[model samples]
Target chain A: MIICKVVGHVWATKKEEHLNGQKLMVVRETENGGGTYVAADLVGAGIGELVLVISGSTARMALGGNNTPSDMAIVGIIDNLEMETT
Target chain B: MIICKVVGHVWATKKEEHLNGQKLMVVRETENGGGTYVAADLVGAGIGELVLVISGSTARMALGGNNTPSDMAIVGIIDNLEMETT
Candidate 1:
């Protein structure tokens, strides 16, 4: 699932201890109308809205993990985005 | 896993109950040698670094559950990304 915005948030106080309670944001990838995909963000979205990111290993269960060390998250938060042009 | 590049960061408080302490970053996607596929960041990656992301229900696993409500996570940090042209 992809169609994003939320363009910013990330700060780490010496990370990797199972990511120590997580929330990260910063997405791009907007293609409901066109193209472009910027990555990074563990949900907690804002900016331009229209989000729904999830990548490999199911993004390590949305951060809870394949032992932390995240891949991607931001499960949902899209009011409306439909594309099925045949 | 996709080839990626992070150009920045994000920060927030009073987000979703499940999205308490995480980090974010954004940018347009990059191919190993060609294409473009910018998406969000979930891993603790740095500028110009390659990372791996997981999506979907399994993304739920990377986090903790389908309950916490996330969809992606950084599954691995890529050291190499190779694509073959047919």
Candidate 2:
């Protein structure tokens, strides 16, 4: 999992049937500045909120089963993230 | 999953027991330059080779079972990747 900032929404009506009823949001990596990618939202994340993103099979499993075609998902809304400065 | 370029190797003698005997290679996203991350190599990929990477539960499944603690994996060596620029 990684920390990301919810940047935008992806409104897709013509998408995979498995993705129906799922909320898709664009998130950018907070720590590494990894470019934005679309992720299914489970935590009702608002734009500009810092969130925790998980990818792969874990993503699909989190959505209830392995039928969903999600490769990434917002699993948590982070309240605080502490990092030590070296 | 996405296409990435193998840039280097990760030599770790002390790692998760499930990771033993697995080859870990560092990959950088090819198109987006999404920076670098380490992935277990499923295919025989070498440095500078373009490969297909999969993450999350799919990675752990590809490694064999749920016992492996892998989140990313190199699944294929790309012979070619075609994209049309608009």
Candidate 3:
């Protein structure tokens, strides 16, 4: 998973059948200034929260292989990131 | 899944326990001139073969949640990519 900050929410009344009622959020990847992408929200991540976004089949697994037609999923809300000193 | 072409192989005698015996291949994503990255191979894709790669938890599902410390997996060898006439 990659570190991303929730930038905004997306609303689409009509979409893939399996995606109904799921929250979609705009996320910006925190590495190398990667641009924004929409991702299905697995956790109740609010805007401005640090989150872990899992992509691909893992994103599909979020809904138990129901074919959500999305590549990214917010799997967790990161509370903190700490580093250790050598 | 994203389309990529296997470029080379990687060998690491010591790695995450779940990654033992898995084949690692270098891949270059076939979009927007993306750079190369390492991914675990699932479809026996050889160098220069266009393949589908799944990332994140989907990658972990490649090994049944064994925590393989990888973010990508070669899921299929693409025989063709056809776009219908607009």
Candidate 4:
């Protein structure tokens, strides 16, 4: 899983049939200036919210085992990050 | 799919059971200087070779779909990129 912020939305009239009704959002990784990528919203994540994104087969499994054709998906809205202060 | 260059190799004596016998390599995306990620090599790609890396369920499918835990896999070695000049 990767930590990212929901930065924007994607509106597509023509896309893969499996992508119908899926909410796509633009997410940028919070650390390391990671590249931005579109991810399906599975957890009602809002713009500017810190989210957890899962990719690959784990992404598919998150949506109940359907062939959604989505490589990435926002699975959780993170409340906070717990860090161990040494 | 993403285009990347094999920059290095990863050797592990102990790893996930599913990752056993897998060839893991460090790949850096050629375009946009994308972040580096470890990918399982499915096409016998060597260091310094430009290759195609597939992610998500596609990676698992390329390996015959036996539930490999890998999220990224080098599927092809690119000889060249064809671009059309306007």
Candidate 4 docks with a DockQ of 0.08
Per-residue lDDT of model 1, residues B1-86, tens digit only = 55445544433333335644544444324554432233334566775676665556665556665544445455566787777866
Q: lDDT of model 2 at residue B20?
A: 90
Assign candidate 4 its CAPRI class: incorrect
TM-score for each candidate, following the candidate numbering: 0.44, 0.53, 0.53, 0.53
What DockQ does each prediction reach against the true complex?
Answer: 0.09, 0.09, 0.08, 0.08
Docking class of 1: incorrect
Off by over 4 Å in 1: A1-86, B32-43
From the highest lDDT down, the ranking of the candidates is 2, 4, 3, 1
TM-score of 4: 0.53
lDDT per residue for candidate 1 within A1-86, as digits (tens), equals 45567777677899777766676666776643544443345545677886756555555654555676776666556554332221
All models, RMSD in angstroms: 13.2, 9.0, 10.3, 9.4
Error of 4 at B49 (Å): 28
Quote the RMSD, in angstroms, for model 2.
9.0
lDDT of every predicted structure (CA atoms): 0.54, 0.74, 0.69, 0.72
Encode model 4's per-residue lDDT on A1-86: one tens digit a residue.
89988877655443334556877776778775565666779999998899999887677667556455556789999998996645
Evaluated against the true chain A, what TM-score does chain A of model 2 have?
Answer: 0.93
Docking quality band of candidate 3, CAPRI definitions: incorrect
Candidate 3 lDDT, A1-86, residue by residue in tens: 55678999889987878888778899997643476999887657889987656566656655446466887777656554432111
Going through the candidates in order, the fraction of native interface contacts each one reproduces equals 0.16, 0.12, 0.11, 0.09
Q: Residue-wise lDDT of candidate 2 within B1-86, one digit each (tens)?
A: 45578999989988879899999999998645567999888768889987666677766766776798888877656554333221
